[model samples]
Target: MPDKITIGGVSVDTRHWIGGQRVASAETFSDSSPIDGGTLGEIARGGPAEADAAVAAARDAFPAWAATPRAERARILHAIADGVEKRIEDLAIVETTDNGALLRSHRRGVMPRVAHNFRFFADWLLSLEHEDFDTRGHRNHVSWDPAGPCVLITPWNAPLMLATWKVAPALAAGNTVVLKPAEWSPLTASLLADIAAAAGLPAGVLNVVQGYGAEIGDALTSHPDVRRISFTGSVPTAKHIAASAAANLTPLSLELGGKSPLLVFADADLDLAVDLAVEQYDNAGQVCLAATRILVEDTIAEEFTRRFVDKATTLRQGDPRDEATDIGPNIHARQLEKIDGFVQRALEAGARAVTGGHRGDGQYYAPTLLTDVAQDSEIVQEEVFGPVLTLQTFTTEDEAVALANGTRFGLAATLATGDPERAERVTARLVAGTVWVNCFFVRDLQAPFGGSRLSGVGREGGTWSFDFYCDLKNTVTAPNGFTDHG
Candidate 1:
């Protein structure tokens, strides 16, 4: 077993969340590994006090940090990316131990993506250019300003990667940040703070606090000093945060849950569809953009289900650290229980388990595929953040689009088809933020990533993230006579 880790720069004798250089407490909570029911460490049950401290620290640093030159800020981000690359192994181990994600997935899939995000945004900052608009006979110019101190709350499923999605842009836009990492997986956030310090970030520029949502999270979201809040989690939690932000009229960016769909046309490459489906369930379907509701055209539904079931059944589930393991345990026991309940409810509602519906003693659920799930069932409507996919069939293009858009989620969609005209038509009609014509989960950091509707507002990644974290200011100039006449 690994040794217990400490937050901030000092080691505390008692369990408490650390902000800046202080040890504070609200309650005590033990963190356990999902791989086995073994205690990993304990965090100070941080409540309102810790959250306030973190916000204060961010407010204090905002003036200097925001005033810093863009080039200098870009340098710090680049250096942190370098530090992360150097210690990839250590970070991957801690990430897997905390969340039961496969070590290879973290090392290969997540780490590189984060590194690319930093580099891509760093270049964006350096090359940022103001737009000049001609307003009739007057001259107008636009400038982007930071949104002041920001409160960032991230989920456990893809902690580091998702955190980077916000952090890189917020920093690039010159905002001080107070980060609240999910209690289930705090180790990676702590390690990231250490890396930032090594990269020469100013004191209090980035603050991390770990605790329950009701306690610490409420304080951060409601704090007056926090000018903006960016959160990624469930839809219900997002609604609560939205309300809290509304009370203060603070700006927010919420990346809520999704029940994303994948459309398989009759002309789609069958072999490719099966491979993508297997990979979609690779991380146990914890991803917000997991293509869970597979809508296949009736003409090919039989063949696709047969192949999809065959591949999904062969996925290896075991210890996350094992290199060959394809699927690891869920993030926690509670998550496993929630997933089980959803499956059982769907079964009772007349859904049939096509393959792999068994649960192990540990926090592990086999990759499950269900058929004949009612369109309005909980399994189809709710975001099941686990390794489960419910298959449905559609006879026509209009039916496929209707079924895909049935849920409130509009995050992502996958369309596999060999027909070029059909791909173009379906891709244009899909009500999703991202549409993959021939692939699934394949993304580039330079592309804008986000959802259309309840999947969340605003965008992340590419040059768009800079716009999200910054406030656009339009400057207009006119001759004295012209202004007086108007």
Candidate 2:
């Protein structure tokens, strides 16, 4: 392996960006591409000291940034959008190499979407309706101000996009930020620091700390200067962060893990349902909102299973760089093992793999379909987080809804029904943050996105994001009655 990996025509020896400088640490760790197991490069391993420096930088910059006019903040955000758009291709390549998501999705879907997020949030601020009212002869003025220094911890699944999801709104609301990208995928986040700086974000206003969550995350969340924390990762880790935030009584927004379900009714269009299945398994099924649990009505279960397995068999698992590839490798060796273990356990418990079920070389797993699986089986109950699907049959509408909401997660779900009334009725009963009636994975920039139960704690995107990243202060004024009192 080379001493340094070149991405986007630049050599990488990863370092944290603190106070607008690329700062190195005494300790560092190797970062490799999950695609081919090739070494990407070495990245600084930040400890508490580094975290402290990042928090301190954000703290120093917060007041000035907060005091910046909202219109100016919106302008900078638009500049950020332009910067992101300018480097979209390069950013997409870096993200794909680091995270093993399909290059096409990263380039054509995620990167552009991230740029759009900045634009969306920027326009939202410009079009905002500031609230003011009068009651009891007193005028109350409500306005939003930056929520001070905030720490954003994003997952590796879709590093640039997910990080932007938090960063855009936070910056748009005039908050200084310290970002901790997942160790597994830190390249793009590092690149983002450069983009933001070039877009004219002030020094110490935005910083990127690249390191493992355990060492640096604790310090950032527990830092007294950090007023708010927004994290996207596993439920267990979110819980730990929540605990840490409690020490300072800091506010938090967590978008945790998900084991979402997709239900197919007997009256649904089978072809469309199959298409939805394919969409759910997109991104190698690593998406937190992917449909892992498929509940098909008993009457049509047999045909649905056959068609689903047929479609699953045809999915292409190959080099992520290949635009034609449908499934990419797992993010790491450990993740590959976890996905394999879950499928193996289900097989041991009498689940049948009608099509692809086994692991391939170098962290690649075949798109799998497991039928005849018990609802209580680990494969159905837990998140496999690979291109694997488990099928179960339900005899009644209530039963289908029950199976869909059976998991501890409530991130997202999809229900397919020909009858519009049935679709509405079932959607109302499904316990998820977002429910699609006849489609899967449809998203809107204006819609609020988050989860229920263990999935997440707060909503993001649209106005919800603005609310979370800023503090709404209400001021009241009234006429004095001093003359009458005297």
lDDT of each: 0.82, 0.87
* lDDT score of residue 143 within candidate 1: 79
lDDT of 1 by residue, 1-486 (tens): 122454223322233223345354645688788889788676666789887777887888888988999999999999989988987777788788888899999998788777766777888999877777777767788877888889899999988988888888888899988888898987787777778877988878888787888888999898888887899998789889988888899888878878888888888889998887777787778998889998999989899988988887778889989998988999988999999999988888899999866687689997889998889899998888998998999998899989999988899999888999988888888888889887877787668888877898777776677777888888898745354555
Considering every candidate listed, which one attains the maximal TM-score? 2
Question: What tens digits encode model 2's per-residue C-alpha lDDT throughout 209-283?
Answer: 988878988889999989899999988899999999998999999998888888999999999998898777787
TM-scores for all candidates?
Answer: 0.94, 0.96
Error of 2 at 13 (Å): 5.3
Off by over 4 Å in 1: 1-22, 479-486
| Clashes per candidate, residues 3 or more apart or on different chains | 2, 0
The candidate 2 region of ten consecutive residues with least summed lDDT is 1-10
Candidate 1 lDDT for residue 144: 76
How much is the lDDT of residue 424 in candidate 2? 82
Q: How many clashes show up in model 1?
A: 2
